[model samples]
Target chain A: MTVTTTRLRGVEAAPEADTVPLGRRRRWREDAVEAVLFAAGFVSILTTGAIVVVLGKDALHFFRNPDVSLVDFLTGTVWQPQLGKFGLLPLLNATLMVSGIAMVVALPIGLSIAVYLSEYATPAVRNRLKPTLEILAGVPTVIYGYFALTFVTPILRWALGARTVDIYNVLSAGLVVGILVIPLVASMSEDALQAVPRALREAAYGLGATRLETSLQVVVPSALSGIAAAFMLAMSRAIGETMVVAIAAGAGPRLTANPLRSAETMTGYISRISGGDLSYNSVDYDSIFAIGLALFVITLGLNILSGRIVRRFREVYE
Target chain B: MTALAPGSIGLATSDAARQVARRHRVGRAGLAVFQLSTIVGIVVLGALLYNIANEAAGLVAYEHKTDPAAVLPGGRDLAALSAPELAAVLTANLSPGEVATLEREAPLAERSQAELRRLVDERVLETHAAAAWNLTDSVLDRPAIEATVAERHPDADLRLTSWLSPAFVTAPQSGDAEYAGIRTAILGSLWVIVITMAVAVPVGVAAGIYLEEYADHTRWLNRAIQTNISNLAGVPSIIYGMLGLAVFVRALEPLSSGGAFGAADPTTANGRTILSAGLTMALLILPLIIINAQEAIRAVPSSLREASFGLGATRWQTIRHHVLPGALPGILTGTILAMSRAIGETAPLIVVGMSTYITFDPSSPFDKFTTLPGQIYQWTARPQPEFHHIAAAASVVLLVLLVALNASAIYGRNRAQVRY
Candidate 1:
């Protein structure tokens, strides 16, 4: 293919080449352009490498500190940076609570919306509603944090009693984060649902199945892997989410399951501590990097798993 | 095949009919539930906007330390006064040391009328919200609110205040929430976004072009680049902040802080400036832009490339003249959306160390800066209720800005569809 293209270009450019050696010069220029573009593309690889090296290097510094034992860092419950307690459980527990609550809110609602869009709605309805749903995704997370603090928390306090609900409880933060990720879940699940072949639905209908039966029994099951991938991706996003939890979820990390109590996630802890003045190379500063490294690995693992599930389990239809 | 008796067929039974009817009912209920799920998203959106709007404007009871009329000679109207006259009012009301400090910051006579007016508000009148109410209560329970204000603070004057007024947009940040505005934050955001676009667009689009038109999928390096970009897109934004801190703020401090250029801000001779923040944002949004640009380029028909190649056009020539023009609109739409995302991003900027209470606008990429979202985050974190009100007001402004960007992107997408 390359030889034929070069021959064609040479024949066409013979006259121009005679005047100015255009063919060889143009080929060199094309190669240069290709190299430049490749460099641009290579930046992404460099970015990933930078993130790993930066996080990994600082994390190593944090673990190497004699005061912080790796076993205690992972196994201990308390996470007081000032007094030298560097347990990962409290932050990890809070992260899980928030993400769990978010998933509880987002998964069913997102899947339902996907089912509605793919199996129930007309094209006109889908077109109008999809963008409206996207508006949810477009909203800044900081605004969601504000909503969680000023709006959602008030309602929670009014219902759960102001005394029972801390001003910066995890419940409100998680609920708002859940609301924030609904669009992600809905859109991805919708794509998965839409990808299910129409013939499956027709086959179910021919067997006298109800619309719900067809969607739930045939379409959903066939699209299960894709939906699972969506769920995983949403979970990853919730885990990585920063602003909402930082603003609404409490500042101090605590290893507790009670949603009404104040607790901080990994992300909340990072943002809160980093926002304050921390002296360079201090243990406090290095701890945030350690947490960031953990966050990056977890989210990266989930994303890769999500991608694999989608690719490996995708049903190929003629 | 054996023939079945008509009476033995279960399809005609009343029980079968009832069961079928029940199934239909269940289906209808399920459909309603699904529809309700979709509506939940819209409703949450509505609630968020309403909550912000409610806080952005309302009734406030102000407690002024000194009346504006008392500052001026013969009780002249404050708005009617010139810059120097306003400066005189500030000088007359403030201490001698305070006056000297104000003069040192800038010659009081050289200050603009607007600046002088703001100073009078900040220093002379010293007006602050003694009591505040949301728009809902202000409109629906006005009599009760008035009574509460009268009972709670008799000296304070009651009036309606829109936190998101035009003046609010142009005024600089202040220590006092009542006097604070988002001008500096807005300018900071604009500068950062300008730098973000300048760096991200060319690189992102070029990467897209390479991946779509030039990459050989058989090559492992090309495949690795593709996979790497996809993973980068999923990486948490805060991690990017850490990367920026390590790379731009620390490792490349001389360049990022403008020390290399000999233009560093004396107070903040570190890399926590607009340049570092912008570069961080560029990295955060680069994968997004590349993916979108690739899709846009992919949407351009292969036939267009083939036609160009048939005319003996070089690969770069075909891409420059034919493919790029076709993909420009879509690429622009994606870039604008990415830009909007960068504009509203707060966590990364926070990690990159944005000063929460910057009063002066950032004049260059190497200046200490704050963004609108960063300001909102700061205000919301404050203990004072009035700060929350202003935070909501800032949120409204930020939301409007985002909506406008998104609308333009939608418009561009429509135009692209029409052209195709």
Candidate 2:
């Protein structure tokens, strides 16, 4: 009661010039600014809503269409969407094949690069080399697509006889995509390795462990979850990449697992088909959304799972 | 240390010490391998740049079907003449019926000066010298190329041509490789980027402010929002293209097509316009901008806020006058980087209906458009080898634009560093 009375007395004693019109206007302006800021924050939520609703509604149409059977979409091998064979196996397998190849190529090299950056290089070398790798990362995917088509594929064919490799094989695309993701994997894993407390490395070193041993056994295992997250994220990137596969991985919807042959990924399918003039609400048009829904769910699940693992394991070291 | 003693080992040769030395060697080898892998990455980056640059510059020998002396007065450069002057030349050269047919195909009066110039080059010149050497062949196998040119066409005029000349920048897309330019694509990209910036910058900055400054940590809703934004960042760009097709192209066609505003062209009422493409790109880069802006805003010192509060400044006043100015440079840096990504992006725009062969400049948001990357993609898809050389030249242009954008971002960051 005494505090309230003192505040009231202070306000009463304040000059009218300070307390009346300007104070009210200032308060009003503050509220307005906050409201505007709040609206800005709300737009992101609105975008999420739009994505969900749009994908959901169109995907429902695709499933409900008489021509498409959920059974075929899940289990069948062929994927000629225009012919009413909406089997997702071909597309999914191709996506997995490409991602698998990308992982095989990128994992060792990217980790090695990260290991060198974190445990081996001097500060100056690290600073100079990190941005050089970033230049690779920042080059547009379309350019990478061209590089795969014009350079990598010919090199592959020349290395291993031309007959074994089609002009637009998944091998070249996957390899180029791997090169693209190397920087991502390297940088993320580097951050994870760096986050390993210095004391742990010193403890291993004091026990006469070599730098490689400390980095591999002590530092790396401590940062294993982050490394795994990097792998998952890179795989997600590989699966969703469009231009490289569209340009180099060929447009054929082959269900084969051979990376030497051309196959269409989910993203490649969407890019190729969407470029065509499909009438609205057509099966082919609606099918793109269904495929997109699948991509969204897979990537979303991988990201969330990786994020959870990273968070759950982070506490152990922190 | 005693564990490694020679006497502690059962062998006279001290097996323990030898084992330690072997392990050390293994470790050294492992480090060498890691260093080699890093070198591999650098080498790959170097090779990519080399390959692109190899294709960007070269020698070319062209044989003109019609002599310039026959077409123009005093054998002047085709580019030296204005649109009207070129049109007059065409009128004097072609028969009256042929002139009428040419004008009907693309009204001469409606065409831009650049378009008129291209028309004269295409029709009057009848240039059919199709075989071209790439940068690699032209330089490394110069003797071979010269031999082929000399043997094949003794009358052919030989001159080294830069694929990326001033004419290349100003010319629009064309069927002929020699005449194709990136002017339309550049303008389209600029238009799309302008809309992207308009939509993304303000919203992204505001979202960052709210998240960093006003969000209540204890609220589950705010936490959910935070999680959603991060997840959105990891979402692949092509999926955003799908979202754009569903929402912008089909669902919100009225607004995206400008139909609701009564500003849309009746014949081109389709929602696949620059506006839809820009909004889609804006969505794709929104999370990136938001995350970067949040980091920038969060980096602002807390003491400034405290000092403002101590000075009787309200939270809004403190943020408006102090926090924003402090964060502006950082925000600008992030925004520019996001813009760079949006500019180079091709997949989402293709899915959202960027034409592969738009020859005219996009005058409004509702006009159809193509980007530099789209043009490159189109050119690469062609069967002709000459198209690949031009595509390489186009990639060079795109890379230069990216570098310029990144340089500005770096400059902004440096300025921010000085201010802080």
Candidate 3:
């Protein structure tokens, strides 16, 4: 009797639920939701598309323009875009010089910080120091710009002699940018070091190795891939860092190798152009996009390479 | 291994043994060197903080273009006067026509007393800071500074200027470095963050939920999407700026500038509106949010879902009731971190045509805007030395805000972990 009554009630409620296949409405709703979710996920892909199309379209205009020769764009020594000397080397050189100086400053310090944090410090000390490092990491690039300009530039001037160093020199910007990436490298390297199996260290110690010998020989070697990945990531960041270089690296595309002289980076060039008032659709304007394309390719390649190194070479210990 | 060698074992006190001992000594020294390198990073961070702080506080010789006494007519310290008294002084100093125009621009009666006083400082009594020195220089070279002040502007009053004062935070940008403040920029930053979070949070979380709960890992499309998202996360931020320029500032100009919606601000019809900037920022942080949210969702134990399913709940029901709540804290943690990144970002905004000198506060998303970082960038590029102090002050503000946001994120993470 109870089953009959429930069946009757279900039959009554069925029509109110709307006509469709049995449970079709519910299934449709769920499927629609899933589709919506999938579409939402696809927005990220759409962004990549937009980035490529926008950059490619304008860059095509840049390269195809009568004023810009493709060969000259790649091989010319001078990059005076205003003067129609559309060379990529000077900007690329400045970027590399800054990245080189940054690596010199950041690599040793970042690795040391990671080693100390992961291997030497107690957990309490680690907790305290990590946040402190993060404070440095979290500072806005503009602050670092001022710091490079007002503080770092003045110091560099004193050390290199005011006459020798341009007021806006690559070295000052590079040093500060190096400081900026230290926390990133240190944090990533620390993660890599901590991931090294404790068993490896114990095995080394059991074989009469001291703590230093075990860490340097056994653990560091095991974590080399991660460390390498971290350095590459840091290098990518330094190359792309904008304001610090824009403010202190000067505005000219000087093509010279001297770190003490003023030079402009690719990112710096884009920023310098954008900061000013340029008429829309101008070749000079299009050239900034062309520079952006170069920046995008180089950084993307570095990131992919770094990611592969981390994934392919990561040691699994069970 | 060295000890086990035949010669080393036979002659433990010989050359081979000495080499082993020396190797150990060298290893120990290498450890010390590594430790010192770590100290160098810490020292650099400390020095950076000290430098910014010293510049934020300074000594200034103020040469009042117009005397404050003449303006106020009362022997009260400008800082000590009540807001109402300050307003009265402002009323007394400005010509009736000038005050009328100011009121028409933004009514003083409706303004907070602090704002009225700032107006007085700007319009009625012109206070120009001349020959400012950083705190270090102010303390160490006081005599020299004083000598210079005496020689240059003997009539000017000297004061210990903390550039990071309340007035500094409240006033808008001005042509003169002395009058410039980050008020408009701060408001613009808040607006951008609002729009960014509004767009990014829902989309990012939805993507995370789909990837974690609904995505079929066996499917090639899903796998490709997953790879794309991670790669996007690693792309340089400046590239995002370029994307913002071409898409939001140019291609989507009609929508981003509000022309399509028929709500365009005349000044920002070219799509350099706050809306464009906000949308750009939203895209910039989307990958960070999606990645973090996926990790959070992945962390939820399977048992909760199983129990819900066992009770005859559908997939959506189970996810909505159990999975989402479990993942909410983590998602929020990701959002806060994203917000922090968006706040400090300047590159993309600059590309989106963020102004260097916006004085009036933005009224809507369609209006032209600047941000704290943008203002700081502008000031740093300026030739004036006094602008550097204000820029430092702005940096202090930006850092404090970021720290607060990060601290809350840390707190939330800890709390969530404890509950689990």
What docking tier does model 3 reach? medium
> Local error of candidate 3 at A1, Å?
43
In model 2, residue pairs whose N, Cα or C atoms come closer than 3 Å (at least 3 residues apart or on different chains), thus clashing, are none
- Candidate lDDT (C-alpha), each: 0.91, 0.85, 0.87
Cand. 1 TM to true fold: 0.93
lDDT string for model 1 (B1-420, tens) is 989887777656877899999999999999999989888878998999999999999999988788756677778766688997888788877899999998998999998897888788778888788988999999999999989988998878888989887778888998888888999999999999999999999999999999999999899999999999999999999999989888998889899999888897544747889999999999999999999999999999989999998998999999999999999988999999999999989999888889877788789899999999999999999889999999999999999999999998998788776254
DockQ of 1: 0.80
Candidate 3 error regions (>4 Å): A1-26, B1-11, B14-21, B67-93, B102-121, B418-420
Segments of candidate 2 deviating more than 4 angstroms: A1-26, A315-318, B1-13, B61-121, B149-158, B418-420
Residue A288 accuracy (lDDT) in model 1? 91
CAPRI verdict on model 2?
A: medium
Q: Give the lDDT of residue A73 in candidate 2.
A: 83
Kindly list the per-residue Cα lDDT of model 2 for residues B228-276, writing each as its tens digit: 8888888889888888888888778888888888886734748888899
Ten consecutive residues with minimal summed lDDT in candidate 2 chain B? Answer: B1-10
Which candidate order results from sorting by lDDT in descending order? 1, 3, 2
Poorest 10 consecutive residues by lDDT, candidate 3 chain B: B1-10
Better of 1 and 3 by lDDT: 1
Q: Tell me the lDDT of model 3 at B371.
A: 95
